[model samples]
Target: MTLSRRQLLQAASGLALTIGIMGLPALAQAAETVDIDELMKPSPLGDKVLGSEDAPVTIVEYASMTCGHCAHFDEVTFPELKSRYIETGKVRYIFREYPLNQPAYAMSMLARCMPADKYFDGVEIMFEQLRSGALSGTFLPALTKLSKQIGFTQESFEECLTNQKLLDALEAEKTRATNEFGVKATPTFFINGEKHSGALSIEEMGKIIDEKM
Candidate 1:
């Protein structure tokens, strides 16, 4: 089946969250820094955070599930970044959804629907499917496959997608990111409140992270 009116509306309102396609510099301008308190304030869905509270560096990533560069970062850089930084307790990571399209918004909803402990794993699988072209097919079916992989029943999947409260919360999160944090695209990184747009490689990210350290 196709996207419902709710799903269609989800994409249409995104970005106003679309990160412009590449070709610009990797790091955003210096004046774009944000206040950590304001950036970390409460949110509708709350943030999906990983790693230690005491980690010296905090990396906040705003991403769209459908963005190719975001996918590339997920596939290539995130694993290393997570291991060396997040898992090692050097960096605390925060992942926020900034869906750019209908599929992405729906997929973001699906990721949040998974058990809280599995949120990051669920997101990893969604990007993995996107890379494998599994999610490139019909909407619900592909999304259903992902849902099943993470233990969702067909009924549960439909129910989750149709939930207005969750949808509203997700929409509010995106809107807040745009207004408060200046997240204009997928794979935007804020390393210690320094905003940088686009997917970043390990070496590139590590360098900035090193400076923060």
Candidate 2:
């Protein structure tokens, strides 16, 4: 149903995944800075991006598919971000993978394996599952089931899960984030090269974006 094939595989694999249930932190906390040009460097798998390239503000988020805060941001704040900034040509948003565990690694692979046009759709579904508590059920059996709904068969789903090349690329990005940018948590955002760690609210994000503009 899920990965270990992960978050969904707790029962099948007997693995415990701890999500960050801690409430969102204040945005004023500080972190090491990143060079925007270096931050934009692509991994072997490249990026799954949205928004206009010419937007005045650019946000790069390193997130885990199974992180509770990351899922909550997608369920709540991301839509507004997309509508108000991404879609409106005020911001360019780039999402990168930083899987925290085996299950998350597999989950990230699933998103990357999606068809070109459906990459974001795959990512959205993952977060939706995380947010709505769908993955808490039997994911072992449902893993292929969910994949099939989007055109992946049992064999293909398994193949994608075991794709070492893709897995390695995701790992490389995570390592680079750790060594180069000091990204230690899920949902860490770099707004115009300034570091802020948390599931930021829309008003907080808008303030940063406005400052950039």
Candidate 3:
């Protein structure tokens, strides 16, 4: 379902508690395996790649900002992956938006609004805020705090969330992921064209990356 700006803000107002208590494993279990070919289809919305183009392995992630499991991976697992793979240029990591709810859609749009170099920074901040229970209260106040830290003023914050074009683009991308790539849940990973779901441990992710190399 497409979420308008007001609806998304309303969703964000109550999202913190829902995401805080959500079961990550249950979210993982909701996803079904898809063919590697289908999982590896070119992203319709382009990509936000981190690492060298020539990296031997490519990792694509479809994640929702409001998903508890996605937050766990971002907070716990991603640093190691970034250091060992993304930083060393062993893997090219691409993160795609797959908002599961209206709040998630709003957060994704905000991330896109940041300068290209700050996009991932915006995402990490959102995840951190989610983990810290910052979005539990009024959505605008929490978001405004983050926006100020990232150079976004009140005007820009409102404008970004209300950008209909960006919202539609994110919706289209999410639709392609669900309909074409069989992505049923957040934190779904496609490593070297193989689909996996869940908050995979560093060792588990490393093994797969090593095998690809």
Order of candidate numbers by lDDT, starting with the best: 3, 1, 2
**Backbone clashes in model 1, listed as residue pairs:** 14-17, 19-185
Predicted candidate 2 versus true structure: per-residue lDDT over 88-157, tens digit per residue: 9999999998887766777788888888889989888877777766666445554556677777878888
* TM-score (C-alpha) between model 2 and the true structure: 0.88
TM-score of 1: 0.87
* C-alpha RMSD of candidate 2: 3.8
lDDT of 1: 0.79
For model 2, what is the C-alpha lDDT against the true structure? 0.78
| TM-scores, each model vs. reference | 0.87, 0.88, 0.87
**lDDT at residue 185 of model 1 (Cα atoms):** 76
List residue ranges in candidate 2 displaced over 4 A. Answer: 1-12, 16-27, 137-139
Which is the better candidate, 1 or 2, if ranked by lDDT?
Answer: 1
Model 3 whole-model lDDT (C-alpha atoms): 0.80
Query: What digit string (tens of lDDT, one per residue) describes model 1 on residues 120-168?
Result: 8899888788777776545666666778888999888878888777877
Tens-digit lDDT track of model 3 for 111-185: 888899888988999998889887766665677787788788889988998887788888888888878777778
- Index of the highest-lDDT prediction: 3
